[model samples]
Target: MQPANLLLLTIVCVLVAYGVGYARSRSLAMPLGGIRHLKSLPFYYGARAALWCGLPALFVLGLWVAFQGKVIQTLVIGSLPQEMIPGNEGEASLLLSKISNVASGALPPSFVEAPIVDASERLQALREQSRFYMSALVVSVAVLAGFLGWVRIRPKVNARVQVESILKWVFFACAALAILTTLGIIFSVAFETVRFFDKIPITEFIFGSQWSPQTAMRADQVASQGAFGMIPLFTGTLLISAIAMFVAVPVGLLSAIYLSEYANKKVRGVVKPLLEMLAGIPTVVYGFFAALTVAPFISDLAASIGIEASSQSALAAGGVMGIMIIPFVSSLSDDVINAVPQTLRDGSLALGATQSETMKKVIFPAALPGIMGGILLAVSRAIGETMIVVMAAGLAANLTANPLETVTTVTVQIVTLLTGDQEFDSAKTLAAFALGAMLFLSTLLLNVVALKIVRKYREQYD
Candidate 1:
């Protein structure tokens, strides 16, 4: 059976186990007096059975899936003749990719040698065998464990403790997985960034003005000893993000305040959803709007004012990005504002404060931390944005602060560097990881500052 189909069958088996256990518990209880006399609830007995039926089967299925590819590849490679064996990891990967394409019929068998064709056939047979064994083993384990659990269900059993303990471990495992994944990403990027610095100096990367990253692939071609200064990318990022925050913060915060405090229910109901609809629109759509409409408008405006501006400029990208993030700030701030104690508002009003005075003195201070959090989210969204920046602000890593000029961000450069199949050993490819590391650090710094502000306000308010 296919793994997906097997998964469905396993779920069905678990449900069946639950039903059987529940029925058994109820029968045992009925002969005595009621479920109150039992050690634990019938629901806990059913849950314990379900956990037993699902957990071991799922664990076996996971292990099989994880190791199946490596085992199959080893078998196929081992079966090949001495002459056909790959010498290195890269060669092995390429050979396996070709074999996969041929097996999948993307490449004709006639195009490759007889040895590869034999290996592909071997690959297919091994995969089929693995799948058959995996399905049978998983199903058998599920059924056996389920039967044991159902048989164990009795009036004297305390299933609740066992079920709760299992659930706590599961939740802890999930949390650990999340933390491990994050650490893995950080360490991977850090290692690659170290490799990048081995080729390119950290001083140049951090402080130099030029931003080219090209390198000669062959001796026949001219070598451009590429510049890897990241100052321009970071400068562009800050410039655009500042513009976006300037546009988003005041407008979004004020809208939130109005929706939460000043606006009547009918107006709030109508306008709030309309305002939040801005967030649901795709970033690419915003990109198109910035490129087609906002860029041209800004250029014409600049020209009419006797100032020169590029058609594809940071101003256009940043402005439209601000519009896109307005809903994020507005919605979050609105919720936070509403969460401020109603007693605070009532006391302020009863003391003869005006509506605006009450909002300013009582509610807004209490909601400051949450409002800052919303704005920080908007800032992060602006910093990480790529599509709108790509479409509206052309990707030139120029070291200039002019909002009217073309520039790029760290994210845009990372995407450009890592877009195609490239050799990771090259400094050109490894530079993406360096830029990503720097971006990560920059964001972490931003979060630290925001957290400090949040804690200060929270202490006062809480």
Candidate 2:
């Protein structure tokens, strides 16, 4: 069984044991000579038993699974014929893999050898035996624990409280798992970035303006030195995000206003979902629409107006990105607007202010915090968006503000850096992580600020 499956099985076994214990205890404590329980429910006792049996066993199972592969490989290699072992670790691993495949009935003739074959067979048998023993042990422990828990149960036992406590722990574990996963990703990126910094100075990477990432093909081959200035990328991301915000904020806010204040049920029912549909459209589709439809149209329009325009102008990409963020901004703003207490609106109307006057003077100001929060979120999304920029925005990292010129964003640069042939240890690859780190920090900061503003505004409303 896969380790994940085994782990799941172990958990199920524990829960079953707990149920069994709980049921048995309740049955024994029955008032009459019938099956009715006198004390806690049967399931509670069983669950308790299951928890005791399953947790320890599963913990051991996880630890063993983590270390088993390396330990087993080492043991197998030590047992192999000395002559059959390859000189390099990589080659030896390949040989070991071939031997394993052969034992599993997938061995190729080129790697087939009598000693290796024998070793593979022995390893397979050992693994199978170990699995069988472990399974038996798990089952035995679960049953034993369940039986013991059953013996301990009484009419006075507070099964509900115990169950609640167990559930809380379970929830805590799930939350920890999620947090650990995020931490793991961060650390993985950070370590790789550190490795990259070792090859290239931080100063050069951060401040360099020219971003050509080509490396020398051979020791003697002439190659253009790669430039890693991130200004252009940052500029592109900001520019596109600005354009998107410009498109989204006003439209989204107005939509929110119409829906919350003016629109009747019939209009709202039709419009809200339609606006949400914008969010469901795949970004790649938006990318192509920008490239094929919007880009050309805008370029032609600009030319007719006596302005120079690139086929893949930032304006086009930014405009499309703005369209993408509109739903996000509107949906969030709508909720915020709706959340504003009706008392305030009623009070404004009672005071002789017109609907528009109340919305402009009282409601909009009150909902401004949430509206800004939504806008900040949209900015983050626009900054991080990759596929649209990759397709619609040109690869040129021009650090210019002219919307007519093409530009690239950080996400696009990261994609290009890691794509095609790449040496993982090189400056180019590492730059991707640094850029990612910066992006992550920036978004995180924005979210924090936005959340803080929302919280303060919420307090005011309350």
Candidate 3:
């Protein structure tokens, strides 16, 4: 049986075990007059049975699925004649692909040698045998384990204790998986970044002025060993993000304040959803709007004012990005502001403080940490945004603070570097990982700063 089919069968077995355990528990309680006679409830007994029936079988299936392909490939490669064996990883991969195609009837038998045809047949036979054995073993283990659980169920058995114990470990495993995954990403990026630094000096990448990264593939080809400097990209990113935050923070905060404090229920209901609808619109749509409408208008206005502006400028992109991320700030700030104790506002009012004065001093100070968090989230959103920047800001990599000039961000360059068909071994590809590492560190620093602010304000308010 196939893995998917086996999985379905195992689920059916678990459901059956649950039903049997539940019924038996209730039956056992009949002579004693009620289910209260049992050590634990029927639900816990059912759950324990289900866990016993599912866990071991699933563990076996997962291991088999993970290792079967590699085991089969190793066996096939071992069986191949010395002359037919591949010399390197790339050649081995190519050979495997061809063999897979032939085995699946994607390639004709006549297209390859008799030896390949024999190998393909062996591969098909081994796969079929492996599936049959895996299905039988999984099903057998599930049935045996379930029978034992059902047999062990008694009026004195503590099924709830066993079930809860298993569940606590399951939750711990999930948390560990999340931590491990994050560590895996950091290490992978760090390794590639180390490789990138080996190819280009750390000082040059960090401080050099130029931004070009194009490297020649061949010695005879024309290319500038290309600058790996990141100063320009980081500058553009900050410039665009600053413009966005300038546009977003005050507007979003004021809107949140009005909605939470002054607006009636009806107005809040209608306005809040409409405001959140901005977040639902695709970034691509925002990019088109920025490029076609905003960028052109900004250019024309700049020209009218006798100031120079690029057809695609950072101001246009940042403004549109700010508009896009307003929902993040407004929604979060509204919640934070609303979360402030109503008694505090009432106390300020009773003391003869005006509404505006109370809001500015009491309410705002209390919610400042949460509001800061929202702003930090919006700033991160602005920094990471790519579509609007690419469409409106243009990928010029200009080391300028002017919002009216063209610029490119680290994210845009990372996308550009990794977009096309590229080899992972090249410095160009490794540069993307380096960029990712820097971006991660930049966000980490921002989080540290935001945490400091939150703690400082929280201390003051407390």
Q: Which ten-residue region of model 1 has the weakest summed lDDT?
A: 215-224
- lDDT digits (tens) for residues 132-168 of candidate 1: 9999999999999999999999899899999999999
Mind giving the per-residue lDDT tens digits that candidate 2 earns over 301-347?
A: 99999999999988999999989988998899899888889999999
Candidate 3 local lDDT, 1-462, one digit each (tens): 999999999999999999999998999999998999999999999999988999999889999999999999988888889999988765777787888889999999999988888889889989999999999999999999999889888989999999999989888988998999999999999999998999888998889777878875666643368777889999999999998888888889899999999999999999999999999999999999999999999999999999999999999999998898888899989988988888899999999999999999999989999789768867877889999999999988898989999999999999999885466667787889999999999988787887787777763322
Candidate 3 regions with alpha-carbon error over 4 angstroms = 1-13, 64-144, 216-223, 303-307, 459-462
Error of 1 at 137 (Å): 2.3
Query: Per-residue lDDT for 13 in model 2?
Result: 74
TM-scores, all candidates, are 0.90, 0.78, 0.85
Any runs in candidate 2 off by more than 4 Å, and if so which? Answer: 3-22, 32-43, 49-156, 178-183, 216-224, 303-306, 420-422, 456-459
lDDT of 1 at 379: 88
What is the lDDT, from 0 to 100, of the residue 433 in candidate 3? 94
